[model samples]
Target: MSHAPVLLAEAMTALALQPGALYVDATFGGGGYSRAMLAAGARVLAFDRDPDAIARGAVLSAEFPDRFQLIESRFSEMDRFVNEPLTGAVFDLGVSSFQFDEGARGFSFQADADLDMRMEKSGPSAAEAVNKLSEAALADLIWGYGEDDASRRIARVLVQERAHHAITRTGQLAELVERAVGGRKGARTHPATKTFQALRMLVNDELGELARGLSAAERALSPEGRLVVVSFHSLEDRLVKNFITERADARGRGSRYAPDLPPERAPSFRLEHKRATAPSDQETAGNPRARSASLRWAVRTDAPAWGELEAPALAPKAEAEWKKLI
Candidate 1:
């Protein structure tokens, strides 16, 4: 099935696009948002690390040569390509369905392919982690990144098995995880779901990229420019939520009697809504992938851009351990 951009209407609404104004599609997965912006009479500069997205985006660029442009690079580097001030920016976080459905990409275990999940197809793949990382390191990665409680058991079994034969295929790795967890029985998700998520995030350095991207967007936007982010998982959402909250200057005050106060920083943005928005029931039913997605947005203020925000801290216990492996 073709991947549908999640929360399309809400994102467009949040952006509050101005016709002929410049905007950035931070992760142009399949160009859905870019196409919508073009239809709305806005000029869009789209970025994606995946060569596939760039190849596909060529069509839109050709069709709207005067209005649309596509950049083949990670969105975190937005400032390098963003010469003109942007009126708004939109980021659709996480991997695209194109990577999953294509059997060769090995994003999904349904097909037997190399256990490679690199979005750019250039870095170390999933197979390397599965085969090389020590069992304890692997456990820490799964425990910290995936938030899976069964990480130890999974890692132990993976280590024992990989010692005899390398785990190089998606099917092989999935089976190993299932065996470790005693197989799925009517579970809505695959047994290896979280572990795979952790591996993908680590291999891509997605969290680090997201932190830098938020800062880049801050630097690129013009006053009153909008920033919208749609994240599918808790880790992604947490980072984005914190980044926006900090930049929007959501302040907390101490009690009247006695208390602590947050340090004052220039309010770089104003929240578009007090809360995150989720997909409607109808939308979720049509595309299950949208079920976990949330859209949050803010409008840029005239204040100067804050310097790069700090990356979200990882689980302290596993921080040093993970660094040794990856």
Candidate 2:
């Protein structure tokens, strides 16, 4: 009914929290992870780009007082604010339940509302993206971010419909996408789901934030400290997986084709498990949102932090056009 953090126990175990140690909850959505860290007696610093999450966190800040602090900022910028090396850091990536549940936020089409999916409540919204991007860009965004095969069909319809009137409402966009792609008889989800996801990710630059946030955590975590992440989609999971693998030097030396390349960077983090941890059947049944969650964690090593991560240019045409608006 409310926000239940996926993989809470697994993330905590990976953290191996020590009483009085400092921990960072990089995405303090609904204050779930931060609450757990505080309960474990770790001093907590929580960050969220959403103002509502920060307001909700005020209760935890009040209750923990000296033990907890919440900042209303993107997790990517957390290193700038945190001077002390963290004993552990946890990130719960992607949209929070509160955002999806609140129809006014326009993250879902459960209720008709403005097409606005800006996590920070600022910047170019989903409406701007839907109405402004070229057909090719929209198709690319849908395929790249949403992994939807109907992207081209969806984009063609969107362009045709927007000519009569701007696609400015969640319901309006959803209807257009469904009409374009058509419904699958056995599909449980709406045909428009991926289209909406693509628009939302583009609006918020979700992948870009994840890339930067992971690097920030790597830089701020102390040696032996844990870095945990729970991601909801394959795009996010792959990015997290590759980031850790590359940092841990698990990929080995350069390929024979690129033998002239320089040596690999020192392993800054060590992967305790080569594979990601998944939520239990009970957890997935109780909270359908947890079904797609995959948790991967690594322990920081005594090596220097590597250069910052650059978010993959997944949909360059869409991104470039979106940037022009914002």
Q: What C-alpha lDDT do the candidate models reach, one value each?
A: 0.88, 0.91
What is the alpha-carbon RMSD of candidate 2 to the true structure? 2.2
Q: Report lDDT (Cα) of residue 206, candidate 1.
A: 85
Q: What does candidate 1 score in Cα RMSD to the true structure?
A: 1.9
Q: Whose lDDT is greatest here?
A: 2
TM-score against native, each model: 0.95, 0.96
Candidate 1: segments with Cα more than 4 A from true spot: 254-263, 315-326
Model 1 C-alpha lDDT per residue in residues 1-326, reported as the tens digit of each score: 48799999999999998899999999998899999999999999999999888898888988999999999898989989889879999999998878778889888888999999989988678888778777887888888789998999999999999889999999899999999999898899999999888888877878889999999999999998999999999988998988888778774454667665554767898885869999999999998989999998998999888899777656444445446655
- Model 2: per-residue Cα lDDT at residue 187: 82
Where is the poorest 10-residue window by lDDT in model 2? 254-263
Please, what are the lDDT tens digits per residue for candidate 2 over residues 195-265?
A: 88888888888999999999999888899999999999999999999999989877756576766544367
* List of clashing residue pairs for candidate 2: none
Instruction: Enumerate residue pairs that collide in model 1.
Output: none
